[model samples]
Each structure stands twice: as structure tokens, then as C-alpha cells.
Target chain A: MDPINFVILAAILFAIGSAAVLLRRNAIIAFMGVELMLNAANLSLVSFSRIHGEIDGQVMAFFVMVVAAAEVVVGLAIIIAVFRARQTISLDEPSELKG
Target chain B: MVNPLLFWIIAALTVIPSLSLLFARKAVHVAMAIVLVMVGLAAAYVALGAPFLGVVQIVVYTGAVMMLFLFVLMLVGVDQREDLKETIKGQRWIGLLAAGGLGAFLVSVVARVALPVQEETVGEPDVIAEVLFQRYVLVIEVLGFLLITAAVGALVLTHAPRLKPRRTQLEVQRDRVRVGANPVNKPMPGVYARHNALDVPALDPEGQPIEDSVSRVLKIRHQTQDGAEFRAQLEDPARKDTEEGR
Candidate 1:
């Protein structure tokens, strides 16, 4: 199979992830959509690295993974904080100005 | 180049499970599906000559990231259902259409422009490390700082401050007495000799069963036995005589 197919798969996953972010009302699920998008980008990066015959793409993917990890930590902490204050993780409910 | 069959398998693994993110009602099920997608991506990385990246993907995404998601999920609520009502009329369709268009555009653009495939080196740990340390060492140092900051940030966000002093047992007792509550402990369940069980209520001085002796949860569930019946049988002198003869 052409390695470009990997890119196509990544695009498809990215689309699904976006759909999730838009459609899902739950904060955790939406956060997971973000994770999915990151993973899709990583897949595409690795595929590009393979196509170009260099380790640079893989290294970039590594960096992306680190950032994604950090993002997950802070994001989940915020989710917990919001849930504690509002007692609901629905993204819509927290849209009101007052805490 | 990935094997056609292998790519198809990976595609199936990723694409099918990822749909759950949009459709699955339970956040837990969606989380699990995303995990599967991560694994599939890891496999694709390995297949495309980046084994090192593949391993990191599995360790980081499946092990750490998804586990954190699950922990938060449980902390929030395992059975927490989403408000599926779309407040913005037709918002779901609009979102799906936009995403689908984006995907179609990307695939067409990529497929049309034939990027030459050349697999020079398998991304083993040592090979990846050489590149990582030499060119990206500074990035790595920054990442370490980021991780530490994230850990501290998480602690700060979730940490609940002590708003009030903890009420001690003595203070609690004093408050109960002031409120005119029964300061003494309730009698233990199972007052009778033959029927010593938690569901059996102890009798008060007035010969009435003390309902509070049994657990409130047990009473609510109708799991408690009536101590009144046992007390009545015991009080019957004729029944006691028959019991003694037997």
C-alpha cells in the first residue's frame, strides 16, 4: 500500500475528531476529541517522515506527544475544577457567565 | 510502504471505532473507542518505518493519556450521561458536514499529489535518540519544564481549600445536646437472644422496637426484619411453656 494512505487515514480520523468536538456535549468526550485530533496529526507526521526518508518527522511527533500529555493533564484538572463548582461536565451548562 | 492488507486492517481498526466519539452516549464507551484508535495509529506508525514513534504512541496515549481521561471520567461520574439535546437547531448536521468536507478535501489533495515514498531508516530508539538529542535537545529541555508546570497546575486546580475548621466529636456532641437530640448512642440492632442480626431492631425501655437501631439503608431497602414479631412470641407465656417442654 502507498504510505500516503496513512495520511488519508489521519485526515479521516481528524475529521471524526472534529465532529466529536462539535457534536458531543460532555466536556470529557470533547476533550477526548482533541486527543484524537492530536493523534491524527502525529500519524500524518510519521507518515511524512517515512515519505521523506528522515528521522526529523519522528522527532517532531515525539515533541507533539509531550505537549499533548501536558495538555491532557491541565485540561483534565480544569474539568475536575469545573465539575466541582458546577456539578456538571456538560459544556453547555457552564456557558453562563456566573460560576 | 505498508502492506495493502495491513493498511486496510489498520484503517478498519481506526475508522470504525472513532465513530463512537460522535455517537456513543456514554463517555466511558467513547473513551474506550478512542483508545482503540490510538492503538491503530501506533500500528500505522510502526508499519511506516517509525517503530520508535509507534512505541511512544502506545506508551503515552494508551497508557498515560487515556488513563488520565478514565480517572477524570470516574472522578466526575462513571455513568454520567450527556445532554443530547442540541440547543442550536441543526448544529449537529452542520458540524458533520463541515468535518466531512474537510476530510474529503484533504484526501483528494493528498491522493492527487503523489509524494514519493522512500524508507531510508527504521526509527529504532538509538537512531531516534541521536536526532532527538542533537538537533532537538533544547526542545526536550523545554518539554521537561512544561511537564513539571502541568503537574503543579493540576494540583493547584483540583486542590480544595479548608473553608471551615473540622468539627470535632466533642463539639458535635455539644451541638446535638443543644439541639435537644438524643445525645446517647442508639441501641444496637438484634436485642433478642435467638435473633441477633443487623436487620433486627433493638427494643426500647417501653418494649417498643427501636426502629433507628437498624440501618436506614436496610430499612429503605426493606431488608430489615420486624423485631416486634419476635418480641410478641417471646412474651407469650403459653408459647414459652411449649418451647420449654420441647
Candidate 2:
């Protein structure tokens, strides 16, 4: 079986994740959408790693996970602060930051 | 090379639950579904020969990230209904259309690209470490710094500034007395000599039921028993003599 199939799956997951980000109104759900996108990218990286017989892609994926974890912490904290002030977690709630 | 059966299984596991992210109404249900998808993704990584990543995915995504998400969900109120009213007219339809178009475009692009598939490459921790420590050592140190900054940044972001000076115990007591509140602890619920139920109010020295001694919640719920009824039973010679008396 070709490892390329995994790359295709990654693409599908990426699309789904992007849709989630675009469609969902909840900030935390949108945040999870961002996570799904990152996971999709990591999947592609690992799949490419296997196709190329190199360990570098897997290493890149590891870095992505670390960065993503950090991002989650900061992003969620911001969400918490927003929720505390507004008493709502809806993305539609805060229009003050809308550009 | 991964098994087709395995691929289908992992696909179903992830895609089905991932769909819940789009359609699930409850934020908590969406969260649990994502946890399922994360676990499924871990299985996919393991199948792709990145066992270390698979392990890390489970530990980091399921164990930590999703837990934090749930913590925030709880903090933000579990029943906080999503304001589904579209502030932007036709936004939902537009979003769906745009996403569908994006999915179609990506599928087409990926399908057109033909890549050479080689032998099964198992991502051993040793090879990963060699590349990581030798080539990506600086990146590793930078990530550590990033993590520390993130931790501090979160603390800074969520920290609530003190809006007023902390009230001292003396001040609190003084305010209570000023408001005509009992400086001493309020009498606890339940007559110790009689029934000790929280719904039973304590008898004051005058043999009257002190209604405030019972919890406000018990009274609101209509679960409070009449302390006077118990007292009446003890005092009633007529209740003991009559068949109709409760």
C-alpha cells in the first residue's frame, strides 16, 4: 500500500478543520479547529517522512506539536479572559476587536 | 506500507467524530468527539511508523490539550447556549459553501500530484533523536523558551487586577454588626434534642421555631419539616387521645 493515501487523508482532515474554523461560532471550538488543522499538517509531515525514508519530517511534526501546545495555552487563556469580561464565549460576542 | 483495513478503520474513527465538530450542538459533546478524533489520529500516527509521535499525540492531545479545553468549557459555563442567530446575514450558508469549495480544491490538488512511494520507513526514536539533537537542537532550546513564555503569558493574560482593597476580618465583622447582623455565628439548622435533619429548624429559647436556622435552599424547595409540628406532638395531649390527629 502506498503511503500517499495518508497524505490524502491529511488533506481531507485539513479541509474539515478549515471548515470547522470557518463555520463554528464558539471560540474554543474554533481553537479546536486550529488544532485539527495542525494535526492534519503533522500527518502529512509524517506521511512524507515515510515516503522519503527520512526522520526529519517526524522531527518537524514534533516541533509542531510543541508549538501547538504552547499556542493552545495562550489562546485558551485569552478566551478565558474574554469570557470573564463578556460572560460569553461566542465568537460573535466580541465585535470590538473586529477588523 | 500501512494496511488498507487499518486506514479505513482510522478514517472512520477520525472522520465520523470530526463531523461532530460541525454538527454537535453541545460544546461538551463536541469536546468528547474531538477526544475520540485525537485518539484515532494517534492510531494513525502509530500505523504510519511514528510510534513516538503516536504516544506523544495521546499524552499531549487527549491527556493535556483536551483536558484544558474541557476545563475552559466548564469555566465558561456548560449550558452557555451558542448564540446561533446570524449577526451577519447568510453567514452560515456562505461558510458552508466556502468550505465545500475549499475541500473540493484541496482534493483536486492533492489527487493531481503524483509522488514516488518508497519502502516502509519506521521512525525509530534513535534516528529521530539524532536529527533532533544534532540538527534541531537550537529549535529545541527555542521551544523550551517559547513554552516558558507561553506559561507566563497565560498567567499575565488571565490575571485579574485587584479592583478594590481587600476587606480585613475586623472590617467585615464591623460591617456585619453595622448592618444589624448577628456578630456571632447564626444558629445552625436542626434541633439537637429532636430530629437532626437539616430541614428541621432549631428551637429558640422561647420554644419558637427559628426559621432562619434552616437552609434557605430547603425552604425554597418546600422540603422543610415543621419544627412546630414536632413540638406540638410533644405538647399535645389531644393528638395522643384523638385518632384524627397527626
Candidate 3:
């Protein structure tokens, strides 16, 4: 299989994830979209690692995974706390910061 | 020869579930879709000859992170559905247009670039570990600190504060008489105070149930089970439990 196929697939997945992040009203779903985008980048990294015959990309993928895991914990905590304070998870409802 | 068909199938699996995740209405369904997508990505990693990455993807992303997401979702109650109404005017159109534009640009660049066809490297765990601990050891240590920060930050963000001021036992008795509910000193018969009776949720001074998401869900459930009479008793605190007389 051509490595470009995997790159194209990553591109498509990234697009879908970006769209979800921008369009979804739910904070948790938008957070999931961010995760999807991160995974797409990881896929591209692995494919490039395969094409170049190097282990650097794979190592980078590992670091990305660690950061992503940490991000999910902090992001979900903030989301849950907001839900508790306001009783809703809709992004539209938290316009109190609007100046 | 590696099967091109397998790559195509795995690619389809990866893309389809991610799309479904965007469209899923409930948070639980979204979590499940993310799990499927993570598994598909792991298969794609194995197909790309990164067995170590595939295994890590499954263990970390699918196993630990997704489990955390689902646990938080259940704790926060899945009954809360997002409002589908567009919050920002034309936000959906703008998002679609931008995503489409970006995808087109990336696809064009990818199609035009020439990737050298080299022998695929098998990323064995030993080689990855050696490089990780040797060259990237500092990064790994920093990541450990990051994880610690994340844990502490999550705890701080989700910490629930005490709802009311602590009162002395004598003060509690006076307040209980003022509110005219159950006496503070007497425990209900047959119910161990610590086991069941002592933890009876305190109502607001107005005798209304606390307005929180979980209690709101439990209230709805109670209403559905007992129908109109139960709902009336809930709304009116004046009604005594006639069943307790038996």
C-alpha cells in the first residue's frame, strides 16, 4: 500500500474531527473531536515512520499519546465542573464571559 | 506481500466510526464510537508495521483514557442531551467550509508529494524502549510531571465544597425545631442512623429539594415510577407519608 493513502485517510479524519469540534454543541463531544484529531495525527506519524524507515515518528507518537491522556483528564474535569455549576453542558449557555 | 485489501478495510473502519462519533446524540454512544475508532486506529498501526504503537494505542487510548471519559459521563448523568440549536449564527456552515478547504489542500499536497518507498521498519518494543530511555529520557520524565499536574488539577476542579456552615449539636436542635422537620436527636425506628436514616438528604430552607443535576434525574425517575400522586407529594412538602402509618 502506498504511504500516501494513509496520509489522505488522516487528512479526511482530521477534517471530520475539526468540523465536529466547531459544530458540536456538547462540550464532551467537542472534547472527543479533539481526541480524534490527535489520533489522526498519530496515524500520519506512524505512516511516515514506516515510509522513512525510522523509529523517531513512533517515539513521537508515544509522547503525543501521553500528552493526550493528560489533556483528557484535565479537560473532562473542567467540563464536569462547568456542568455542575450551570446544570448544562451546552457551549452556548456559558456566554457569561461575553464582554 | 502485504495485503492492500486489509489496509483499505482498516481505513474504512477507522473513518466510519469517527464519523458516527460526530453524529451520536448521547454522550455514552459517543464514548462507544470513540472506542471503536481507537481500535480501528490500532489495527491500522499494526498494518503499518508499528506493533509497539498499536499495542500502546489500544492500552492507553482505548483502555485507560476512554474508560475515564465513560466514568465521568456516567457520574455526571447521561440523561442530559445537548441542544442542537446553533449557538453561533452560521457556525456550522463556517466550520464545514473551513474543514473542507483544509482537507482539499492537504489531499492535493499529499497527492503531489513523492514519498520514497523504503523497507518498512518493524518498531519492536526493545528498540523503542532503548531510544526512549536513552535519547528521550528527559521528555519521559517531564511527561511524568505532566501526569501529576493533570491529576492534581482534575481534583481541584471537581472538588465539591460544603453546602452549608457547620453547626454545633445544640444549634442543630434549634434549627431543626425552627424548620419543623424530623427531630435532630431522634433516629427513625428500625433504621440504623448511620446506615440509612442519618444520611437523609437535607432540603432547602423552603422545603424544596436541592436543584442539582443528579437530584433532578432522581426526581424525574421517582415521578415516572409513582405517577401523579408521587409528583404531588414531591412538589408539596406538607404531605406526610401515609404509608409510614402502616
Candidate 4:
């Protein structure tokens, strides 16, 4: 596929994911949006890396996958703890940490 | 031609569900939307010729990570009653202003700046790795350490003391009784033993005298049968009353 086509599709996915992350109230859903955004960036990065015929992008993408996995584990654990303590999963209620 | 058309179709598929993620009130539905987005992205990655990354992205991000998220959410019982509200205050105005400013800046820059001149094409994947491991090895090692620390941290956080049902008051009292002590409805050590002396006989099934005799504890009514009760003093008050009356 042409790099331009790849770039455009990725941009659209990223934008939509950004909107979801910003607009949603549910933390899980917001988390999904974040995943969407990351994948969007990954799509573009891998595509361009291929265009340039470089393996670094694939390796970086691998690192990103690992990091994203770690993030989900830690992030969800925290979210679970927060929900346990607060008795709610609404991201809005956690705003008490505002300083 | 087919590749571009397929890319556009996949983009549409990706965008629509991602938008749905924002609007859906139910968290599970939103999770489904996110799964759709991840699958779409993997397809996009495949289309871009990075099949390996595409598979890893799906396996790690969608299969492992998101599943963990869903599992935790389910385990924690995040139901419809959780009452999700927007955390960001005045976000609408901020988002609007930021978007507008970025758009205006882009327009001005696009008008003034020439299109980027492409750099001389770099060769194969090995070159990228050569640069990375050669110069950026320290950064890579740090990232690995960061991930290990994170995994351990997550393990500690989620592995809290399991929520076993708490021991009930009766169970506690029963335990005390079985241990030859009174846990409730009685004073400190020796006091309750003395108090229940006349009524309870200061002994269990086997015969033995109780210690620490007291007058006050003898007043409580003890039931010998259903709907029948008598004062502890009834058993031994004559000895005490005869002396006191004299």
C-alpha cells in the first residue's frame, strides 16, 4: 500500500481514538481509546518503517507491545484498587487527587 | 487500486467503532468497540507489510492486555450502577480552543513552509538496529528494567489479601467458649467466670468448679428450657439471705 494511504487512515484512527479518550467517562472505555491511539501510531510507524525498508520500526513496535501489555496490567490493577476503595469505576470520581 | 480501497474500508471500520466507544454508556460495549479498533489496526499493520508487528500487536495488546483489563473490570464488579461521570472540568472549551489554535497554526505554517524534502532513503532493517543497539543500548536496557519493575509492581498491587468472609460475633463467642473463655456479654478475665458461677455451674460437660466467684454476675437470668428462665441467686440465695437478714 502507498505510504500516503497508510498515513491518512492512521491519522483518522488516531483522531477518532483521541476523541473517544477525551469524551468518554468510563475508565475502561477510555483505556480502550488509549489503545486505539497507540495502535494508530503503531500502524503509521510500521508502515513508514516498511516504506524505508527498516527493521527498527518493527523492533520498536515490539517494544511498544511489551510496554502496552505492562501498562494494561498495572493500569487495570490500579483501576481495580481505586474502584475497590471508592466503590465506583467512574473516572470522574477519582478527581479527588487534584492538587 | 484494491489496496487503497481496502485501506479506506478498514479505516472506516476502525473509525466508526472507535467513535462508538465514546458514545456507549455501557462499559462492556465500549470494550467491544476497542477490540474492533485493535483488530482493525492489526489489519492495517498487515496491509503496511509489517505482518510480524501486526500479529504481536493483536496478541499482546488485544489478547493479553485488554483481556486483563476486562478481567479486572469483571472481577471488581464494575456494573451499570458505577455511575460514570466526566472527570474533566471545562474540557469542552479547552478542547475547542486547543483544536482551533492548532488548526490556525497549521494553516499559517502550511502557507509559509515548503513541503518537506525527502531524505536519502536508508537501507534495510539491520541498519536501523545497528544504529539502535550501537548508540541506544543504554536506553533499551533502561526500558527493559522499567518493564520488569512494572510487572512486579502490578503483582504486588493486585495480590491483596483475599476478601474472605469475616468471622461473625457468634463464631467469635463460640471460639472463646471452646477455648474455656468468654468473649462477649461479660467483663474482663475472671469476672465473667465468677458471674456465671451459680447459673452455669462454672463447668462444661465434665464436672469442675469455676473460680473467681462474684455476687453481681449471679443476677442474670439463665434459661433451662425454651421460654423458661431463672435467676442464678435462686440456687444459692438462701445461704446468703439467712446471714444478711440476721
Distance from true position, residue B88, model 1, in Å?
2.1
DockQ values, each candidate: 0.84, 0.78, 0.64, 0.33
Query: Candidate 4 has what TM-score?
Result: 0.64
**lDDT, candidate 4, at B82:** 38
The residue pairs that clash in candidate 4, if any, are: A55-B125
TM-score of 1: 0.91
- lDDT string for model 1 (A1-99, tens) is 788888888999998888888888899999999999998999899888988999899999999999999999999999999999989999889767666
The interface RMSD for candidate 1 is 0.9
Task: Output the number of the DockQ-best candidate.
Answer: 1
Interface RMSD of each: 0.9, 1.1, 1.3, 4.6
TM-score ranking from best to worst? Answer: 1, 2, 3, 4
**Candidate scoring better on TM-score of 1 and 4:** 1
Q: Sorted by lDDT, highest first, which candidate order results?
A: 1, 2, 3, 4
Between 1 and 2, whose DockQ is larger? 1
lDDT score, residue A86, model 1? 85
Candidate 2 C-alpha RMSD relative to the actual structure: 3.0
Evaluate candidate 2 and give its CAPRI docking class based on DockQ: medium
Q: What does each candidate score in C-alpha RMSD?
A: 3.0, 3.0, 9.7, 14.4
lDDT string for model 3 (B93-113, tens) is: 998899889889888898898
| Runs in model 4 lying further than 4 Å from the true structure | B81-141, B161-246
